[model samples]
Target: MPWILAPRRHRVAAGVAAVLLAACTSVPLPPERPAPVEEVRPTVPHPPAANAVERARSRWVPVDWTELPGWNDDRIAEVWPALRASCGRPAPGWAEVCARAMLEPPADDGTARAWLARWLQPWRVEAPDGQVDGLATGYFEPLVEAVRQPRGEFRVPLYGPPAPGTMAKPGWTRQQFDTLPAAKAALRGREIAWVADPLDALLLQVQGSGRLALTEADGSRRLVRLAFAGHNEQPYKSVGRWLVERGELTLDTASWPAIRAWARRNPQRVQEMLWANPRVVFFREEPLPDPSIGPRGAQGVPLVPGRSIAVDAGSIPYGTPVWLDTTEPLSATPLRRLVVAQDTGSAIVGAVRADYFWGWGADAEAQAGRMKQPLRLWALWPRGARPQ
Candidate 1:
């Protein structure tokens, strides 16, 4: 397969926030607590700083390396590729550090951790109100089976954008696209491929980009990417939240998988369920070059599963190494690791909110769909290069 160039847009799960936030309702979050230090390392503390520096959306409080929870226990070498990936599109004031990183790739976890400690300092990200904790959610790239031309059960179409001037400014709702002649006429002949299930199409659109295992008309199969092209501009509504509100599912059980199960049981109402969300996303087809490489994030670099995260660029710039202290999806097991800020999202607004990118496949989808945990982060920055 050949790699094709495609525009990278914000790859947020359209209604993830609404579903996750609804799940967290009525439950007060526990106060921030640092993980117990398991490894003892001699360290020199920096001289006291004057105070926390305020950014546009958050405050950065300089902190000692030891203050970062579970920092010593992480396999720092695991994140080296992601670190180098960030260096490809280094953020402001990162040229010097990126240059050094390119030349001094570490040999082991110990060396990586040491090299990072020597080159960078850790800053705790907090809200302006001095709160150090926030919510963590998850997103993933969906994989949907498709065909070049509609055949057999493959009736639902994945469309590209409408003719330039045909799209309404705030375009037709999802229902309007299905029922109204003007809306249907506008999108006619824009089909990129066809799939068996409408839910699969929605999954691809919700995540903004996905893989299509396409069987071309010649009967040969190849994987391709369908990148987000544009949207209807209609307001997004959470189908998961809709089910929760109507007593079909509880907050805890309102995951993507659960939603699909509900749709199966109530097949006749599947379209009704989909209509609950007003937005419809269009896509452009792209060639898949390397099966190992993930989709390009907003940073214009391929994402690394388990190592890439979407953050508010204002809170933490793209290419910054972030120490994430959070838990596994729907589990209390601590999941503290080093990840990079390489993407952003519409719902991912605030000082501490994050969307963990769980790559592609069934397990990734499962984790992303259920991951709504509390979070704390420390950005590892080149010494004296902290954004003001």
Candidate 2:
């Protein structure tokens, strides 16, 4: 986890926005029904953590089912896949529940809720100081164009990791890779694909993985998936924050669009913009087994959009079933639901803090960009199970 600074952080351009059901191709999904307008709550940040040990950062407060917001409102069926995925690699204290789940899985919302209630207990997540509210952000899969060879517009190379111990100790920084002869030699023949926009390439590195829409020499298009291979081990710095610190953009205005616009206006500084984050990620090509499945997460399973969440793995393990209470992206309407701890991120570093996976495509991008709100979480632990 090189502070990718993954699978969730990079935001792509809207023109290429669409989900790839498979690695090399996909069919356009039907338009989704428009969401009804609803009142939304304002996003607020939680209090800063005091200097305390990891144990004191979060505490579980036992609560009944009724305590969860919108406990029964979610289409629990959507959650079943993510949870079932977790069954393959259950976190500590989750084996029994996951085994039970595998033996007799739920088929519908009613059945799913009933099943969860019978076997799992909802424990409200909070800090030792009883601070429940925490920061809630959004992340999405960026679909972009690429080429197999470095021809014309596709010049920037997306790389695979060099052999272990290739670079001295922690390896070279992102800025040093292209200029250093040794670094270039080490990365020789490591390209998985090439893309036109350097920003798009950087986004893929930042996001850890993405769908690459390719332009074949035969004048045909193909899509492929790039999974995280490794990183340079350099520290990740936020380019957005870097710009903000230099008074180029405000916190509210430092998004993908804004960042790119600023880059275009100042072309000479584009390299500087990129070099701001020294943590360069490498990628590997992966096969698409199931069209319906997305990329694997920290939980060692596919993630479910709107149902999969990235949390601080220190507080919640990868396979924990959590009931999250938050607002819809860019809306105050409560977006409470059952989510699986399928992934982790560098920035996601608190007990109640979460990064909501908005899935793939245009709709997901729209939602993920504007989503920074307050959140509360309740981990659904196995009945009679306690933290050891």
Candidate 3:
């Protein structure tokens, strides 16, 4: 497979103010608590102070570069791919910056850093309650085993959406995966691939995309990536929170590993847990060009392992350069870096909300599944663009 050069057109909407609608829905959210501090990042190394906190509106507060922790140390050049990808479809107020960036690549790390400082301004987003810190999580492309068709150990089917008008409604609930005749009939001949573990199927759907190792009849294996296509258009419910609410698991013990362990122990209750989230995501298979690059995010660009982030589309438009200030999943070590808002998720909402894109494999999964940390974001907008 070859690395694809695809253009991502970011459709911009009104700024972070629109995310208030999330409160009306049942999106799974972490408890509100002050962020645990294990690392205190140094502020701008050479700060003469060029920015300040402006008035607050719907939780977005304009702050100067001096306030962005670790802003001066970020390897802005490393995220060029992420920047270039969004340049293909630069959003409102971003065309000039994206255009300048595409005209020539940065000369060096220092030059890249200079370019960002010269052309962009940073704005710190806060929550509605005037809190600068908010929840953050991690998402990644899962690696799993699958077959071209149903085989000995592969019985579960991962499907694409039924043809237009084939579905009984615009969307199908989780129960429709097996119950609804239209839903079952619609996917009869549309199996993307047959994965061995039902748990893998559940996670792929939740994560919205992944890569699969396909075993041919002769035993040769090849890796193919699954990208999000469409969904059953149903609302999402969190099984973890459901378990917590039902007294089946405590909030402290609701990590993915724990959930899977419980699933194994109570196989009979697995279906009940699986269907707790009525949202059923569909996928489209694509070529996996390189092991290093991740799948294209909602911004329509390939994600850069540790430098890409998924954010609430309402809170932060795709293609916006963000000075991410957060901690590593468990260690609380500073994970500060420059990341692009290239993706979005159902569970991702609010002004300062983000979901860090952590590449793939067991290590990535472990990090992603355990991540739920305090987050603060600084959107680096083009200096010459309209105020965000």
Candidate 4:
């Protein structure tokens, strides 16, 4: 999905002493309630004539592109049964489990409460005053604040600090994170809760605070703060210049001050702009060599683009090949294709299903958002190996 950077909000003037005091006093809180869980119903499409278990043990090989579309649908359908059989039903209290799972380890019940307070303090909830319970208040506000703070210090960047801007290089787009092995691995085996759907496996990655010193292939380094989903997933050329071309603003519009002014004058428009441009991203305090590594060495596997899958890496090694088949919107032809499991994510933690990051920028984000369909999957592993 596209990662859009939300325009920074304007800040009120504050004395340096006050700023220092605030920094010293503010402590982060963990989320209180666990993430909500919804029920997922299994849907079995027509079964594949061949046994999927047998297919999974074969060597990686390419299938005809034309036949792939049909195969993908069949694969998704067949794999769901296997996934259900392995993972079993979602726990009776799975929501709490999922929510608590998102927290860093070493968390206890009391720590979880404090963390919720720190995380939820910044959110603007619209529920009634009485309905605004302690849990909601504690969880969202702190999380939002954590997102606003700097990567290391957990302090928000000051407006007048005049930080230096980093230069961008050619051929490196923001969407490259989707293809990174580390990011994929981090997402594996984790269940994601969606706003609208209980069983939606696609998780939205939002903005987080942190600075990174990224080393390019050429060994050059550049420092940048994480703004994961801040900007609309549109290409800089499309959204950035589009703003200029449409007379919404100029290339040299007043930096943060001017942008904040515009946002104040057009709050709804600003919200629309932000909602339209969301991108998926991963960020943490210290720059991780690979964002994909999870709590342990477990790897997140990416489903093939334009296909659906159910995966259990304990049973299937990374880099295994798979085939997927599905139908498309209003098209008579089935969408079928071959893919290599190259990435993974938290929302992809199903024994029967997986997600495919469409890869960088606006066009990719647009495609990823619209992908909801039934599928059939077939795995290709080594011969004579038992399924993990």
Candidate 5:
């Protein structure tokens, strides 16, 4: 009994000491941590800038010449005979010559090429010096100097129809011919005169009197009266090229007829196609002549009297008023007037928009239909020198 009591206290103390030693040896500390890294971003690229000339060139689109309704094979064939006859005897290399002449007629002197190079800046193709086997290959020259010095002249609008003295042919009509009531109504209360003709009966008068006085080096003075008729609504070169580049037409295939034909085939696309072109031209006092012959052919839009004028708009500031005068359609009478060049059009390039004086009758209609020609232009600006 005495031995059991002494051992109990000693056993309890031994057990407690053993437990404390085991707890101290069991646990361990965590290792030191590392720092985080940041993510890197990639760079982006930009498009290159366009140069001035490139920018200018970009404005033009190619036209589908064959799509034009006027370009019938029969019509082309018919015109070829007249062209050949006018060109005289065909040389061995005549085809190219004929093509060039048809595409771009030569000046009266037969020394200058009529096709002006848009990129060349005032230089146009003159007659080529060397022959491609005796015929001229073609040449280039400055347009401002090579052509006859441009005399300062303005174009005037013609209204209604041809006056009594201007009738040159007999009146003719066709089944498809129908006058627009809007046009006929617009003619009322407008200040204009009328004329009669054997062909398309009525005529409109826009310009009354203006003259061109050309002075020769020999001191001789020649006064020529400017007469003009109808309006123009076509684009020049640059805008045409732009249309081609934009997939509207192919270069080889994009002639006036091709485009016109395409338009006829897809009448719904006409407005879209035209709007995409962005280079349409409108004339106030002059008319575009039809390339076709005969009385029954389609005529272009007649000029809206007084309120319209032709404009490039890109070059000339919009809303500027201009004075125009040109020779009368099919006649030598001078037409002149003041017009507001307030609009831009696809075909209205180089400051040459003719405002027509819309008159009455078939002769006027025919005259309006038959009025279009290459013309010189002058632009007037306030506090700035007039531009040519």
Candidate 6:
């Protein structure tokens, strides 16, 4: 999470363009039939397929179902919830396809695979330079115990945005918010809750959203979600990268646990480490009606653990099903699967990069912290539908 910026913002690149999928690592279909031409709504015009490869932020090369690595092995039914959730707010070219998805909820793996094959076309995602290889990182919601007000060891405050008429265009940096009297006064009454650890607050901010187990004044407990509301609008910096540059840690050893261990060893410098990243994210508290539901992503849909991915909006539109070809973190175990581009991150740019959402809790934190791996992608667009 420290490596990626907030997942709340949508930062699509300007001037939408399409790139071609690299042929080097792909299994091409026979030339007898060309890839199906995507049909988009008249409002979102598409360049002719012939010229697609020549210009664009990213490109797509249609590949056969067999070309997607481990396409047949995934437990397709596991993706149903995420798929259905995406349909709640279908992308521009997905209304018809989403309608079918909602009407025919596949009950099993085989059925799901067949349904996808019938309605979607898998297109390899590539950079304009035809580069297919990219990086895949991981992020997750951090669940932390908290109190309604600051008390005992719970001193760090989690804030909501300042009132509409009280804030400036660009807000204060983390350092200023902590030390400047004027900046601190601006946020005096905006604290939504308080927590004991600064790192936990940092985690929630970095992930852009998380679940908080709140302890009320009456001693009753309720779980709530703190979703990304707004930010200071300052640039985000990576604390992990900061430690690596300072020789306190190496790139390979700069995981979240490692960072925390370093913080414990140098308690006096914890504030310094936190200040490395000037960005501070504010939150809006929402009721956790269902524990199974994750925080809403930039797409405005609840994310599904292991089934939701944050991608570059310019590279793959939100709600698009993606065939991710990547190995497990720090190992060679194959982790290919079908996921929806239900979210996006500031650092999740380029044609092939993605941030996999691992969900909430301890195990999720561990997995996400270590998940920087090589990746390749295939976007499954609705048949006869083009990228918007």
Best by lDDT: 1
TM-scores of all models?
Answer: 0.87, 0.84, 0.81, 0.32, 0.23, 0.86
RMSD (CA, Å), candidate 5 to true, equals: 40.7
State the lDDT at 48 in candidate 2.
44
Deviation from native of the Cα of residue 110 in model 5, angstroms:
44
- Which stretch of 10 consecutive residues in model 5 shows the poorest summed lDDT? 1-10
Q: Give the per-residue lDDT digits (tens) of candidate 6, residues 1-388.
A: 2243112222111110111111122111100100101111112222335524332468887778988989989998788777777787778889899888878978799999999999998887877767778777777777889999889999999999877766576888899999999888889899999999999988787777778999987889999988777788787777777787799988557777888899899999999999998888888798977677666667766667788887777888878899999887678999999988877766666787777778788877777777777788998988886666
Sorted on lDDT, best first, the list reads 1, 6, 2, 3, 4, 5
How many steric overlaps does candidate 3 have?
A: 1
> Model 1, residue 307: displacement in angstroms?
0.6
Q: Rate the local accuracy (lDDT) of all candidates.
A: 0.74, 0.68, 0.66, 0.27, 0.24, 0.73
Better by TM-score, candidate 4 or 2:
2
Q: Which of candidates 1 and 6 is the stronger one according to lDDT?
A: 1
279-307 in candidate 5: lDDT tens per residue? 11111221113211111000111122322
Q: Residue 198 of candidate 6: its Cα lDDT? A: 96
**Better structure of 1 and 5 per lDDT:** 1
Q: Report the C-alpha lDDT of model 4 over 330-375, residue by residue, as the tens digit.
A: 2445555443333232223333333433322234333332333344
Worst 10 residues of 3 by lDDT: 1-10
**How much does candidate 1 score in TM-score?**
0.87
Ranking by TM-score: 1, 6, 2, 3, 4, 5
- Alpha carbon lDDT at 77, candidate 4: 26
- lDDT, model 2: 0.68
